[model samples]
Target chain A: MKSKCSRENKRKLENKLFKASSLTLTLISFFTVIMIFTILLVQSKPLIMKKPLSEFLTVEWAPHLGKYGLATFMASTLFTTAIAMAISIPPCILTAIYLAEFSTPKVKEYAKSMIDLLAGIPSVVYGLWGVIFIVPIVRDRVAPPISEALGFIPVFSAQNNSGYSVIASGMVLAIMVTPIIVSVSYEVITYVPFEYREASLALGSTKWEAVKKVVLREAAPGIAAAVVLGFCRAFGETMAVLMVAGCVAKTPTSIFDPCYPLTALIANNYGEMLSIPEWVAALSVAGLILMLIVLVFNVVARIVVIRTAGE
Target chain B: MDKRKIEEKIFKYLMISSTAAIIGTLALIIGSVIVKGAAEVSVNTFINDDVALFPGEEHGILHAIIGSLYLAINSTVISFLISFPVAIYSVEYMKKKSLSPALTISIETLMGVPSIVFGMFGLFVFVLVLTRGFTLLAGTLTLALLELPLMERGIEEVVRMVPVSLKEASYALGATTFETIKNIVLKQALPGIVTVSLISFGRGIGEAAPVMLTAGFNPFPPASLLEPAASLPLAVYTYLSAPGQQGKAYASAFTLTIIVLIISLISRYVSKRFTRYVSR
Candidate 1:
């Protein structure tokens, strides 16, 4: 009875209970993250040591010749992602600004709801549209015309029936990522002090000019952070990429040439690759790259947010 | 000069046009998918494995529909079982404790963990290790983890919204903490919980990744707990991407999209109805 009732015992009991839950929570999150990274690391351990992990830096991908290189994949992912970001970020920022600083209440509600609805629409459906609509158009008409018009450009040289071209992939990614950027950028744009706009306008600047010169500069970091979220999402996105990215494992000489994304390799073969450990290795390598890219993107966003907060 | 009048007119038109354009595009997407899906949507699809690729073969989506329902139901049940006790303990009894903040942050962290990463986790650990068991049971458990944080967070919110006055009244009436929770808090939180529950179910139904790994897509009704069953999202994914099934894939996508859209729409309606009630 005394043992059960002891103050020391009660304190110990409470401490144990507390420790149990916190530890459980920690383990759960850590377990999930660690599983993703560790599996990648474990799978890539041999490859990491073999080609000095520098092959991803230097060597061109020659698949049939047994060159397990990532230069092509990385370049393809980065180049088109850059194109997509360039396409999306400006329009997304403009939309956010228009929604936040300009729209009336009814307009704001309607815009936000539409954005939400679009965001909720599955990436697979987006893939179908890209496959059924965009790819054929690009292959049949646009690529050859672009090749003729911009024949000197190294990136538009080869035109294949590779359904989802880099441009198509980039376009789909931009659309997929737009809602996220708009939502976040609009949120940050609204968080800007009304005085920033009012002060600039009072100084004889037109409303648009004030928003451009003052409001845009003030919310630059948040907008950049929003773009980074879009980047992170786009980089890690697998399903739509699998369908729409024209999964040729070659590096693109032109934006018209098809290239497999890091995620597509895994999503395309995650189940069937149990037969081929090489594909497993490839997937794990892709996962590692994906995890690193996303981690860096999120970290960049966080740092920007922190720096902006102090400024 | 009527420069200001022109500016006003331009701004009004721009605002109206932009708003209408955004809604119109989204409406088009939603409407097109429904129409496309409804074209192939049949009672046969819901009740049999009859897959109609083109104008010829009439295969139903019975297997996929059952699999979707089973996975969603199992995940929801598992999440509820795991979350409710922890929720009750945390919201009611553990409110005074120091661990609440830590637990709250943990939940937030889980919420931010990406869905694809969850798929990998399920693949490596649940499907591979603990369960060399890559059956529907494994899939359900994997999804249970996915939905647990969501359900707990929403349930906690609903529970917290219950008034302290009611709790005090129950206490004054000689009710215990457990009694107060059972009698007063739960009933009031029902609508919110129910809505959130539907939302979680909808979310789980749409999850293609973790299910992809844990439940290998077997295109038949699951005969046992260990048997693999095909699901709508997975079917849509494979059929759409896999060679020779592109048409059927589109049909599957249309079907899955309709089901998910309807579920979300209904849940959103429930939330609105509950909000109206709570406001009064």
Candidate 2:
């Protein structure tokens, strides 16, 4: 009877221990989020307090001149991400459609695995590929032809033919994000009910018409979520963009001109900034902005996902 | 009828071509990396530590390879320990009440935060404030944070996949809840947990930005967790950008790619095998 009582006490103790440990682990996420905000705010306080916020809104980013305006970097980030989104969305949607509605099981399996592998490739590898292959291709083959034909346009009027421009980085970003967009959209599209397709077909619509008119409409919100996720991914990408985007800290006048996005700016300059007065603080504020932007994107994406998944 | 037929045909062709384009791009990226890197791969590249300093001299990334393994293994182990418990708590202990949706949202948000931002956070908090300098421990902790969401979500899915009947059977035999979870639930989820850890390992190894900030650049292998270390991705980044070191960069990238690819392939294989087991 005494041994049985001891065993019961031991079991109870183990249960309490496991529960306490698990609860502590679960709270770590909360702790991390709080810690990140605190650290960023603390580090950025120096710059935020001394510099008028208006100074940061200017177009130039010459740190040596005490001008830390983020206009150029913001424009560069938006421009490159816009180009990437424009180029990647159509192909990604089509691929998702093919995977969800059309491909044979064997073909889908192989294609899906390939896409996963593509997604798994490290960003540095992508950057290296951009340096070696994409940059040269853009410089030698794509840019010259475009410049010759459309030189009248301000965006194509650059005399220099260096491939490291906003467009090349955008293209690399497109390649980097295509798999993500395709996979997420594919999941959303596949979740769509088969009965919707059947009803459309039964009502005399073709498979293409059903997919276009009914299925696509139903899955539009989830697809939008996927695009937003892709945008977030492209916006924060550093290494590949830094390698191919020419790292110029100016507002790009043309697609052919070099540019610097917020991420590339931070990655390329953070090391040297530590020694410069107020530079580290300025960089921390930029990091804070980037984090907030990504946070908003993620929150919106989550809401859309939950609503869609709940349905 | 003819218009509809043409529209269908056009759409089909577009989808086929787009799918083909995706595959083509993947093939092109991997193929080019292999072809360019093959020339630079040599026995010396694996053994020489001064590869990054010399433009054309015989050198290798031995230090970087070891450092990467050390970082990846340490971070994965730490992340697993933290994430596993959280997964079990949220999935099993909560018992259908489900942890607050807010917690899930926050975890997802953290996952979406830019890695560069994480690097900055690590730089400010760990590197500067806590450690007072770049160190391997700072990088490892930052990486553990990065892997937390991925590992937690993965283990949650795995635990949820554990059939309820097994737990019920254990309880019906007079097992306590903790006893049932420790034996029946975890035992069934072991393969999936392993798969999740390996996937996180791959992610931790491939990450460069966070490591670059928290772990200062050092060509030599680290002697302790407090010392600075060179990671494969950081090495690749440095070498690739350095003038005249392009060969060494390609070689390092090739090595990194092979390691990442192997981890991914193994994880996929394990998941596939376990999925079969579960279905059976």
In terms of TM-score, the best-performing candidate is 2
Enumerate residue pairs that collide in model 2: B45-B60
Candidate 2 residue runs with Cα over 4 Å from true position: B51-57, B95-98
* Cα lDDT for residue A90, candidate 2: 97
The Cα error of candidate 1 at residue B62, in Å, is: 1.8
Per-prediction interface RMSD?
Answer: 5.0, 1.1
Q: Is the docking of candidate 2 incorrect, acceptable, medium or high quality?
A: medium
Model 1: DockQ against the native?
0.23
Compute fnat per model: 0.10, 0.69
TM-scores for every predicted model: 0.82, 0.97
For model 2, how does the per-residue alpha-carbon lDDT over A82-154 read when each residue is reduced to its tens digit?
A: 9999999999999999999999999999999999989888898898899889889888988888888998998
Error of 1 at A81 (Å): 2.3
Q: Write the per-residue lDDT of candidate 2 for residues B1-280, one digit (tens) a residue.
A: 6899899999999999999999999999988888888899999888888535668667788888988998899999999989988888888776546455766777888888899988998888789878888999999988999899899889988888888888888999988778988988888888899899998999899888888889977778889988999988888889887887778788888898889889889998888787776632
